[model samples]
Target chain A: MTAALPDTKVLSPGNPPLSPARIVVLGQDTPFRLDSGVELGGFRIAYQTYGTLNADRTNAVLVCHALTGDHYVAEKHPVTGKPGWWNLMVGPGKPIDTDRYFVICSNVIGSCMGSEGPKELNLVTGKPWALDFPVITIADMVRAQRLLVEYLGVDQLFCVIGGSMGGMQVLQWAVSYPDKVYCCLPIATAARHSAQNIAFHEVGRQAIMADPEWCGGDYLNKGTKPTKGLSVARMAAHITYLSEAALHRKFGRNLQDRKAVTFGFDADFQVESYLRHQGISFVERFDANSYLYITRAMDYFDLAADHGGVLANAFQVTGPDGKRTGTPVRFCLVSFSSDWLFPTSESRAVVHALNSVAANVSFVEITTDKGHDAFLLDEPEFYQVVRGFVDGNAERRGLAARVG
Target chain B: MAGHETNGHIRPDLERIVEWVQPGARVLDVGCGDGELLHALVRRKQVDGRGLELSMDGVRCSVGHGLPVIQGDADTDLKDYPSDGFDYVILSQTLQATRRPREVLEHLVRIGRYAIISLPNFGYWRVRMELLLRGRMPVTDRLGHQWYETPNIHFCTIRDFITLCDDAGISIERSVILGAGERPLPHPAASARANWLGEQGLFLLRRN
Candidate 1:
């Protein structure tokens, strides 16, 4: 049931065994039944661990990665040679102190960084899944993570946390297994994808599909990659991650390596140059088809819709006989002031729903001009909020702290 | 009354406020300074406490102590909170500092089942004596700043607060007075003597 694929090593050539982390492979007998009703037979998950699981395994924290992020949560990324995406908040004495808690971050199912995605080979077809890959939802991603956690032999998670798409997964994890998650932290995320967000994702998908090199989502078989389309998609999506004030403060009409505008179609502004660099770097690391699948999954995520249109119903824990259990996972929601994509209003809606059900919850909207990406940056207020919430929950869980 | 110790001593007014809060009730403390009262309630009464702090440092300090608090302005943010979302909404010594004291009072009663408010009384004997003798706005220990520098723009006496509550159709369920040292005053409830002698006024009110 758990046999390894013969072509697993050659499947993701670009990944190249970057981080010294564990990679688990699940076979046909242990298939991942996705929301699309398609069963994914053989798949692999790459993950990194920090700190140590306590003797009772009560110190485990699952950190979900965002859309373009990988399992390298607090170390150097093997491919780009850049510092881990969340290094500012996941080190010794940091907000999510690895010294006190065991952290697990896995590259999601539809991601390309050493995970089961469109880039992985289909055991039946003996080729990449590509367009043939079943569309996955946020719930499917959490289901895969649950498997990973169970395989690691941890019965319960002390906390599950993430921001943006990762936060969506955290919410799904809490709802799907209310008793298993002790504390939930979903930052800068919504219970459902807004129409505007879905529209933006549609544009990105269209950009990739427009490229001739896409070759009907079979670029790998044709020995070509849709780098240009993927770059355009990344460039457009990256703009939403920042606020106008931050763009003005950083680049603001300044020329790019020139004293004056080129007066041509070239990148004449510093902002344009920066976005171009971001798009180029993104294409080098991400697969075009994988982006399409991941964005689609996010667009289809609506936690309340799956549970009779009542958001509180999504948090209800039921027994095997389908009776109410009356136990809820504690939640702490956070949002930034300037995050237009997933604003504070969305977090408030979640809080209001939790209140209706009498769930133990806390919410804080940190004042920041860093936009949606503020969660990834070194915002002092954000760090203090996370540290406080995590430490408080840890105390309540009776997990021993690391003494100085 | 059991005093919740933080820095080895509980501010007497805060101890009184904690006593008013029922154990296991959901409380929202508006303008919670450093979340001291909420912290005490959570530790002593085991209440589900939340805080809305206006100052960044206060929010940080509250969060540093692992208290749930959001950095927000009372005058604007209160409208966003759902009605009857909390069992008790407490505004401790921040009413006069708000841009719209009357509107803020209305929001407190609207958002919580009971609104617990504690405010400095401007009609205290020391404030009156200083104003009559010196012919200027008083500078007592409670109201220390001069008029030009004071944040208490809409400062009121106990009588004035009662009249405003009556005008707004709100019912005062209970009231208490505290002297200059933040200890309970022996004056009878709703008496003119309490207005003059009491340095602070604590009221529990609800919508009529």
Candidate 2:
């Protein structure tokens, strides 16, 4: 769901100090190559970290951001002046517990935040990359995060955690860098974007492209924002993140502060007003082209297809002799019962794959009417499961106790 | 039965279940409440243990204890696993609660080289006496609940369980009949004596 953002960046009390951090992970020595065969000479990653890395650096937890999320994990968003997207989950005593483990979150390469994306000026042409930025994938986003993790001198992340599109990145991290991840938590995500998933995203993309002010993806250079189209896109996409029950419970056919319907499509219904607000606020921080790129990246994600059509092969590494070895990383997969966006079947598929390989894995389908946004809300059961896994793994890892 | 319990605390009944498991073997604990039995097996045998629990609380607690557990039903989810996927499949005090005990039993033997199961005996003297005298479902310490409140649906005696195993072509490799307080009742076979005397029965079975 489009996070109902509060217009203040003042971090919650007792949070660890953070420096606005940015690093160039892909440069001339190693050009950042796209899956589509284009190579950018240099690209940077903007990241935020909470808590402190222990002397051994084994306590670092990498928190991957979702489709429209940026680096602000537990603090305020620089652009919207709102609380970071995951402030509820990554606080000092929250499920992620920044007091005990170092937490890092970054804007994905194709996002419109501080990171390099369609909004950034191209070094060569000195204009916005826009649609010309060359498409990126989930794997590519993870490759950049690997560099950031290494740049921080962390040999292995204690945990890699995310939900929704971020969950796809978590799964990619486990598959791509088996040794570097001790444990992984991929919640409310699928190994492959389903046909319906792609369809919904396509509708959002179409909304942006249909807007006349979009200037054919050159709106940035033309000094115009496709606010109407982007807002509509956000409004339509927001529905998928919530359940029909939640929508009905929250608004139903309730009128938006009126005695009766105005009868002229001026958001007479509260749901319409809520969605309009979601669309309008989204345009202020996100770019239309970047949304297109990221959604396309999610659509292209099919872990099974990448591994000769066997989902199990994604978690197993092939050695020089063509022998397959299992990964050492433990995994905990969670899905909300009402999350039709990333259904329990998707998590079950991943669990089945892990089971086939005899990989250590845990899974739960939590009952909630909050739908796909359940992970972002105050779900005690979800937190208990995560905290149990994290704390339990910490015990096994012999990681230090919480600072509290 | 209570789980492996709080930090470093282990249950005796779960410990008894652990004794039947081999070191380094793969195990699937079907109704792993808080994963007490599975965790014990993991700690004692270092087995690659996995659990399936119906309650979200149990699943979370099991995972919290560092055991790999999934939330699922025993009746439906058992068929999802490949045949002989684990060395041992455990269904302790959980068979009677299943909607289809016979089908679940068949799945147990098919999915594991050996299936370890424990259930309260319906034919025990106290249960029979309670029914005969009070004309009500027995509320023994093991059973613990009134008829309406209990999850137990397909209550079986020691002899009944053996008969079901025999009908399913499963061989009973080892067996124990426990009275009150986790003590083994002195009974030789799945006879009327064992069925009537034991409060609960634990058995290790293999596919024929």
Q: Give interface RMSD (Å), model 2.
A: 2.0
Chain A TM-scores, candidates in order: 0.93, 0.94
lDDT to native, each model: 0.84, 0.86
> Which stretches of model 2 miss by more than 4 angstroms?
A1-18, A318-326, A402-404, B1-12, B22-25, B39-47, B82-85, B129-141, B144-150, B167-169
Candidate 1: deviation at residue A135, Å? 0.9
Candidate 2: residue A38 Cα off by (Å): 2.3
Instruction: Give the CAPRI rating of model 1.
Output: acceptable
Q: Score residue A177 of candidate 1 by CA lDDT.
A: 88
CAPRI category for model 2 = medium
| lDDT, candidate 2, at A200 | 94
Q: Between which residue pairs do clashes occur in model 2?
A: B4-B36
Estimate, for each residue in A173-276, the C-alpha lDDT of model 2 and write its tens digit: 99999989999999999999999999999999999999998999999889888999899999989999999999999999999999898879799999999999
TM-scores for all candidates: the values are 0.85, 0.90
Tens digit of lDDT per residue, candidate 1, span A1-404? 35332111111213323446567875445767888998877678888777777778888889999889889988778889987898887766777887788788999998998888899887778899898888988998999898888777688999999999999999999889888899989999999999999999898999999999999999999999999999999999999999999999998889988988877989999999999999999999999999998999899999899989988778767768898543368777889999999999988788766655546666787888999999999798788788888898898788887622
lDDT of model 1 at position B127:
90
